[model samples]
Target chain A: MRHILRETWSGLKRNRAMAFAVMVTMWVSLSLFGVSVLVAEQVDVMKGRWYDKIEISVFLCTKVHGGATDLSANTCEPGQETTPAQRELIQTRLEANPDVQEVLYESKGERFADFQEAYKNSPIKDTFTAEDMQDSFRIKLKDPEQYEGVMNEAVTLPGVQAVQDLHQVLDPLFAALNALVWGARGLAALLIFAAAVQIANTIKLSAFTRRKELGIMRLVGASNSYITLPFVLESLAAAVGAIICSGLTVAALVKFVVIDRAKPFIDTLAWIGWDAAWVAILWIAVTGVALGVIPPLLSTRRYLNV
Target chain B: MITFDDVTAVYPGQPQPALHRVNAEIEKGEFVFLIGSSGSGKSTFMRLIRHEQRPTSGKVYVAGKVLSNLRQWKVPEFRRQIGTVFQDFRLLPGKTVFENVAFAMQVLGKRTSEIKEAVPEVLELVGLTGLEGRRPDEMSGGEQQRVAIARAIINRPKILLADEPTGNLDPATSVGIMRLLDRINRRGATVVMATHDANVVDQMRRRVIELVQGELVRDQQRGVYGAE
Candidate 1:
């Protein structure tokens, strides 16, 4: 074992150029793999934050239970105004539901004030009044995903103007993010394959150069593993270098880009912690090492017959 | 000890066998010379004993292990009991003579103290006492072959197979290598040398096996180089 260790270190020194080339190749490949992992991680964090904030917005009435213009198929029927008693009864029912958490009542005057505040700098603020604003109840649920039940119960209520869901708006954004994560993962798989092949190529090259010594070792009764260790260790050294590099790069990405940029969102809840970043780094490093190792085990067994 | 029971080797896709129904044996501590011209299966004869090429028919027994019956993974363990030297003196060019000699023990997973004690002894036995730090390329052909001998014998193998160990050396150096092999054989390692060197074979006064066209034509007890 000592001899194998000595040989492994010496072999790295003897084949430093190939070792460096392999390290550089693995770094690039593992970095891509790390980025894919981080991207997936960041997407999960964003989804969690946005999903919690998602609410079923029950728009009550602007003109009445029915309006003048036909909005859509799910639009509230055209009638007189939504009665105050009916609105209060609907609010009470929403608050009583176990799925509902907190129901916020927004009158037309409140909605108009919010609009003016949102568009405070725009000249368009002068064009709209509280009459143009619709009154609605923003219903926060215990679990945001159980929104279908809320929509069904609220839409048929007497005072409901129409039901709107922020979840619908957030779905497309989440869908695009999920797509991006899957795309990165697919590309990462390709990069990992390329990295594995490059590792095998590097080992083959090292074996070719050391053919004479290898034959001597064989003649001296060296076991297949004894001969194989040096090649394995050389590639493993490259892998270790790649792992540290990728880990640091990934940590930096999570710190500066994901956690920092999404600070405001993450502040509301525990989205991405250091534990998640650390876990992601470890996961990628282990994967990189495995990819670097399996190739030499295969190629050497085939090419060198050891 | 080594024995061949009608061993024959026909390489893949070859019309003729390299060795044809050739039977021979040599006991422990004996020195023997294998003499033949080129293509007379002398090299193939050495390879058979090392399990480098298995017999297409029959068996080869080396120190009680059958070459044909030996598992592929255990071939190294079988070769461990035997030492091998070559015509080109296959020493690692990048390593010093000390490292080359130490490698023989290193592969066996011998302890450092054991290797430290054994390597110098073998180097001295092979007359390479002062050349431990020199690389093969820095040495002469004879010195390089001496390093090869040092490596082969460092592990104290029971049988030593030398295929033209002195082939590339001049007459004087060839005799020197033969004397070294003679000394190694005297120390209880069975030495089998293959050569067409009439002078070295005539001088050794050892048992001789002669082959012609893959057939064992002569097995002479206490033989010289040839009939002449």
Candidate 2:
């Protein structure tokens, strides 16, 4: 064991430059891989948090400028406003629908209050009153993905002026975040492949240089594993180095970018925690070690021929 | 002990077999010379004994184990009983003489204490007592060959195969190397050497196996190098 380790250490020392190249390549590629994992987790967290809150807002007929506006303009006559009976009927239909998980009534005053709170910093915040706001039904669906059926029905209702599925507002945001995740993952995959090839090349070169020693070892009756172990260990050492580097890099990214910078400013959305960071590091470590060990193991068998 | 039974060996991408239907046997502790011109399958015969090259047909038995039947994984274990010395004195260039000799035992996973004890004794036997710190390039051709011999014998292998151990040395130095190999043979390791050194072979007057174009032309006991 000591002999093997000494051989491995000497092999690394002899080819330190090539070994460093392999480590750096693995570090960069694995960092990207780790970041992609974290990003994927972030996308999932965002999807969960925001998707849970998504609801269909059905704006009912409202009296504006002494004429019915919104859904009333399409469903009701020009001067027709939503009657109390029509509002009650719409509420009962939404509540009875199997896809509708819950229906909450928001009166004009409540809508106006929400608008005021949302746009408090605007100059026209005080200009809007209860009469200017539309009464609405916020419908939470049993399955948010089933919104299209509820939305189409809500739009044609007697009182509803507009049916807005919140998913439409959130889908593109999620799509962009998902694209970022896949893009990073794809690039990381490419870099990891390149790192594997580089490791193979390094192993090939190292084997070529030390072929005389290998021949001597073989002639001296060393087993195949005995002859191949040092090369494998050299690559594994580089991989371990890369894993630690990538792990720290990913942790720093999570700490500085996600936690320190983004979390403080964007506290409304949950960011990835250290648990997710650890998961990503675990992925990087596994990938890094595999990348480090496999290439050399395969190439040495070919090049050493022992 | 080594035995070759109707062995024929053809290397890849070659038209002619390197060795063809060669039959010979050497008992334990015999110093045998394999004399032939280039391409006479002398090296191939040695390789067969070491299981480096398997016979294309028939069998090669080294210490009662069939060369052709030896599994790929077991070849190393089989080769442990046979030591090999090449013409180039295949030593690690960067390692010192002591390291070169100890490396053989090291590869076999010998304990450090055993290696420490055996390496110096073998070095002293090879007449390289105090040159332990010198690398191969720092030594003369004869000294380098001695180091190679020391490495080959350090494990106390039952069979020592030397393919032109003194091929690069002058006649005087070659005589010295022959004497060392004779001493080793006297110590009960079967030594098979392939060489074109007529002077050494004629002086030693040991068993000689001669090959001609992969055919066994002669196997003479106490034979001279024969009329060239």
- The candidate scoring highest on lDDT is 2
lDDT against the true structure, per candidate, is: 0.84, 0.88
User: How big is the positional error of residue A209 in model 1, measured in Å on the Cα after superposition?
Assistant: 2.6
Model 1 per-residue lDDT tens digits across residues B1-228 = 899899887888977678889999999899999998998888889998988888889899999888777888898888888898889998888789998889888877898899889988989998989899999999999999999988888888999999988889999999889889999999999999999789898887889999888899999988988775
Tell me what TM-score chain B of candidate 1 gets against the true chain B: 0.97
Query: What are the candidates' individual DockQ scores?
Result: 0.52, 0.56
- Report the C-alpha lDDT of model 2 over B38-57, residue by residue, as the tens digit: 99999889878877767899
What lDDT does candidate 2 reach at residue A121?
95
State how far residue A42 of model 1 sits from its true place (Å).
1.2
User: In every candidate, how many clashes are there?
Assistant: 5, 1
Among these predicted structures, which one has the highest TM-score? 2
Name the regions of candidate 2 deviating beyond 4 angstroms: A58-101, A106-137, A141-163
